[model samples]
Target: MDARWLILADDLTGAADCAIAFRRRGRAAAVIWGETAWDEEVPVLSYDADSRGLAEAAAAQRHAALLQRFHTAGRRLFKKIDSTLRGHPAAEIAATLAPLRAVHGHAFGILAPAFPGTGRTTVDGRVRVGGRPLEDTEVWRRDHRYETAELGAMLATAGLASRVLPLETVRGAGLAGALAEAASVPDRIAVCDAETDDDLSRIAEAGLAMDAAPFFIGSAGLAHALAASAPPQGLDPVRIGPDGRGALFVVGSMADISRAGARRLVAEGAVLHLPVTPHTLLADADGRAGLAAQVAERLAAGGDVLVEIVLAGEPDMSLGLRLAHALADALASVAGEIGALAATGGETAAALLTRLEIRGIHLADEIEPGVSLGLTLGRFSIPIATKAGAFGDADSLVRIRDRLRKARTEGSLT
Candidate 1:
């Protein structure tokens, strides 16, 4: 009988790792997980198919990487792979791994991560395989809708009914608390929100170090902001209520300010509201519509005065592009004797001056994520910042806020 293989696939790297495990013994291969009905599952294989999209809840570069990693040699490889697991669930996967498995001779298995609410069936609990419990391995995984489908394919091929199981419980401290179930190896953890590239460098950093990490699902506001879809709840950013508006700055997103705790910063008079452009709102289409409108309305209502306490909304691309013209027209065209407009939001903070055609300004408030302060008293020009959404990242929001505070206290705006 073939030995049981519990493949762990989280993101693209997770998938790659699964294939790598069997590379020395079984045929390990990669397959592009194309899109399909959200709740559908198929337990069969046909080599001729598109790659599956590893929906991160995944990022753009990560997907692009998957496309780059899975390089098929030829139809012959597929033909040979198809012969072994002719009627298997993950036969397609088996076929793809045939070449590697042929050399290694170990049964092929897939490892995947469990996504929230996506039906997952796991037969292997936190038990040992030959005195080696699953929990103590170098990696642990879960499955989303797509990986679950692949697993179903595997079970069907092995002539076993689908088994659903939960991953081992993790408990500890800080992020380590999240990894309690796994063996301690100083694993790298990354909050992946594929819509943006903010955390890519870090995620890549974590991924490249393979053996020391098991991906964990953390609630990062930035991840949701950068995701292609607006996450169901808090991931979505909204303009703060009028009562909470402060000196609007630039380079911020809903994720930065959506939290009840983060909102507390505003409620306590730490952050303010700054003017935004229509260009930013339009970039996200409906996503930034309401907030952009609010920013526009505030600026129109004579709020463009020399204020020093507001923050900018998300680094709305459309807003960043157009706000300069709007600000130029407002300042140069309308508000003669214009001095400087305060701002926040990372991308907007950085692009405002160039976009608005202004030369410079000064920084007034100093605040940040960790509460450390920064002051700027000299070269205060158009206060611009690198925003989270500008590069499609969510966690950048926290950094944006922290940077804002630090920038404010560190130097005078220019």
Candidate 2:
């Protein structure tokens, strides 16, 4: 009951996934964003700073300000970064360390950005996705803020000194001592390489045992590790079930993984598939309303509906955010009929939920590695699930749909 956790994520999906990590382990957790009023009584609180699409300096400033505003003496801090090293991770990490140093005399960060279940790992101080170097991955090519994938080099960009704790050190008996020594210098970050959940667990355990507890920095993998190490709080978690309405899916990511998943889900023919084009999203209000009306009609009839953005040929990457927001706008009209909601990508989730006037989500389960199931808070309490753009397999969306369907039929999460 004494352990309070504050997870700061740069995007909505990251916030929900990290918060659900704690929730899965019996802690009361919620994800909030954009001035949302959070319950202080909740043992775990994850805040989406929505800085993933910002410039490096702006992302850093946002993280610094958020940390200063939310960090309390009793609450432990977890900085959630993208597994692929997207956004301004180094700048954000440095920003996080600054305030922690001012508050705790000396602050150190333990960075382990590995989500093995999703094929993201750090080896030889370099990040790899699906056994390929991060820089060689499509995700990095499509969206990246750094020139290299070397953890130490990336951290150095922000003037923070870092040393890589090789997998051997992480698995060795001297890990605790090594971490304590590595973090002895102020503003130092220990970048640990992890290829498995066990390695991450060891790193989490060692960091927690340090003389001066270091702030954690990682994706959902490390969050899961820390959550496993935490003592149970016995708080009642928010549960979600079917509300006798149809499910709504919003897919806004152009990533291949998400695209393929959406295709598979549509191919199954279980839901009414509506493909929306970029031009349609950018068009007049009438076009948008027409799409929303069609979706609402299906939902009103108790039919599952999938609204996906279809990017034909090569798209202008610059318009990704704009298109996501526009898609959210087009779907806003159907929020009231949404019994269960699942959204892919952070931008789409944030924009759509904000439009729905939902202040936050009370996490219920981790449906998949990086997919989170929760209940919306604010205008409605329907079941909602969120996933990062590049976290799941081709069948990920299908699984999410099945989970939501079960929740609806069973009236509770198992």
* Model 1, span 1-414: residue lDDT tens: 111222212222122222222221222222113331111121111111212222222322332333234322221111111101111213333332333333333222212222111111122321221233323321122112222223344335434333222232111122233222222322211212221132322332333233432222211111111121211222111111121121244333223232323333344444434334354333444534444455555545434222212224433333333453344333233222222233332223333433344332111221221111111112332233322221222333344444443333443321
- Estimate candidate 1's alpha-carbon lDDT, on a 0 to 1 scale: 0.27
Task: Report the C-alpha lDDT of model 2 over 1-414, residue by residue, as the tens digit.
Answer: 246899999999999888887888888888998887778888899999999899889999999999888888778899999998888888998888778877787788899999998899999999999899999988988888788999999998889899889999999988988888887777889999999999999998888877787899999999999998977657554555447789999898878999999889989989999888888999777878889999999988889999888887876778888988888778887888888999999999999899889989888888989999988889988888999989889999999999998888877764
Per-candidate count of clashing residue pairs (backbone under 3 Å): 110, 1
Candidate number achieving the greatest lDDT relative to the actual structure: 2
Where is model 1 more than 4 Å wrong at Cα?
A: 1-66, 69-262, 273-400, 411-414
Against the correct fold, how does model 2 do in TM-score?
0.97
lDDT, candidate 2, at 379: 90
> Alpha-carbon error at 39 in model 2, in Å?
1.6
